[model samples]
Target: MKYTSLFTVLLVLMTACGWSQNDKQNTKMNKLTDFEEYVILNKGTERPNTGLYNNHFEGGTYVCRKCEAPLYNSEDKFESHCGWPSFDDEINGAVKRKTDADGRRTEILCANCDAHLGHVFIGERLTAKNTRHCVNSVSMKFVPSLNGKEQKVVLAGGDFKGLQFFLAQIPGIVRTKAGFVGTGSEKPTYESVQSGEGNYVMAVEILYAPEKIAFDDVIRIFMEVHDPTTPNQQGTDMGSQYRSVIYYNTEAQKETAQEVIQELEAKDVKVTTTLEELPSFVEAAENYQDYYFRSAEGPKNHSYTKRF
Candidate 1:
């Protein structure tokens, strides 16, 4: 009897310890919003056309909202038009499906944390795979891949003095430097560029993380800070040195920049922004760097008319 009691006590202690460890591990993730908890933890469904990513077709990875683990890829996504983000495939072993409580549908859950994703349906013939992982937008976060790359875009739109300051404040931007590029010369000085030594322009090189920031956002901010519609001028600053142009680092950036320009045009906003491959970057002289920030009058009184 004594031996049996001792064994039973040890079993109870072990079970409690295991439960505590599991609980700790589960709470290690970032805290979810109330709505996210309702859908991800309670298996609730979002209404059609209301989710953040239902129409999003960006080239990136879809990660679990609760754990940020890789769940799906953009290439696997298809236009199911089902009011939810639909994927024809998932990362291998990244998702698990189980017979739902209704017994008529299979519920899909994240394989890593078992957080509810949505449902999986087969035999749909939507794609070659004929499978769809119908997922909730709130259950996942779209991570733009930018092809596992980071790059710098040099944009010239007249005086970069004030615009460069505002662009640097945007999120996901790694750094911003006032520079001269596309001048054909290896190291064009401010004096040389302004004097038409090359295809000189007052530009800013914006280095950013592709995953955290979309190129579209970068272009949008560029439009906001300066007059893209004007030719070779922003406000009173004129000449080819102040022309509106984007020097993209990669083909992807060039495509994105053009697409954004087209989108703006569709909205009846005339965009005279030029898109081209990035040229050699020559950092501006020491006095030109952080001009607005270091000035005695401060950012409120600056050269650029608009400030973000």
Candidate 2:
């Protein structure tokens, strides 16, 4: 009851259909069973060691069962013998902690969906990190490790920060970063990219798990959130750097982009998004990565990201 108040439930319910809880990350919430609702929505606890992941150690990620947002990695998982899945860390900004209703212990919830995970205990020295994320297995869904199975895609749609801010929220995404691709400039700075340096569009490199989310789905979402119909422009930003594009890694990916374009055509939506091979990519400044998440006010184009 500390976190799952009636008003909170209604608020989450309204945003369940689409991302936009104050314009943050978005993941479609899944329908919960009675017991799942009891533990997650009602803040009930599962019996110790009875959860599946208590003694389970598999190389993969543990995502929130309700909304499927990445929570903890298997590498962070360890045996605390406390009758629950124990982790020393939660994926960056993926989990939020709050005081329990009893004013005794701290509770952890999915930052994306506010689903109850469990409690956190500190100073126990269970590990060198001196932290324990005692989470319920029923609150998580294990995604098998995709280390060797990693897939990547690069896209440019207006602001490098805005595009990444949206794509990073999708499920199974490992990383997203701003970068320069195909501009032919040996060194391209933000100023250079903004000048549309040598026609090299500013882009965001995305690494993801295909088994968890398909390649085509990513393309569709890219088109949904930005104006693919606009040429060399996104919102107020104008230049080649802001052009909409899909840097395809394979023929299949290229074809997928084409199919998405064709579908838009069917809807009378004239999409100008181009598909090109990914010859190379150069990482931009560190500050450009996860820019929106780092700031409360976000970027100048924050309103555009709220579209989808």
TM-scores of all models?
Answer: 0.48, 0.56
Candidate 2, residue 249: Cα displacement in angstroms equals: 1.0
* Clash count per candidate: 1, 2
The worst-scoring run of ten residues by lDDT in candidate 2 lies at: 4-13
Model 2 root-mean-square deviation: 14.9
Q: Which ten residues in a row have the lowest lDDT in candidate 1?
A: 5-14
Q: List model 1 lDDT by residue over 212-242, tens digit each.
A: 6778777876776677888877776668888
Q: lDDT (CA) for every model shown? A: 0.69, 0.73
Highest-scoring model, lDDT:
2
- CA deviation > 4 Å runs, candidate 1: 1-149, 184-187, 195-197, 298-308
Candidate 2: global Cα-lDDT? 0.73
The Cα error of candidate 2 at residue 69, in Å, is 23
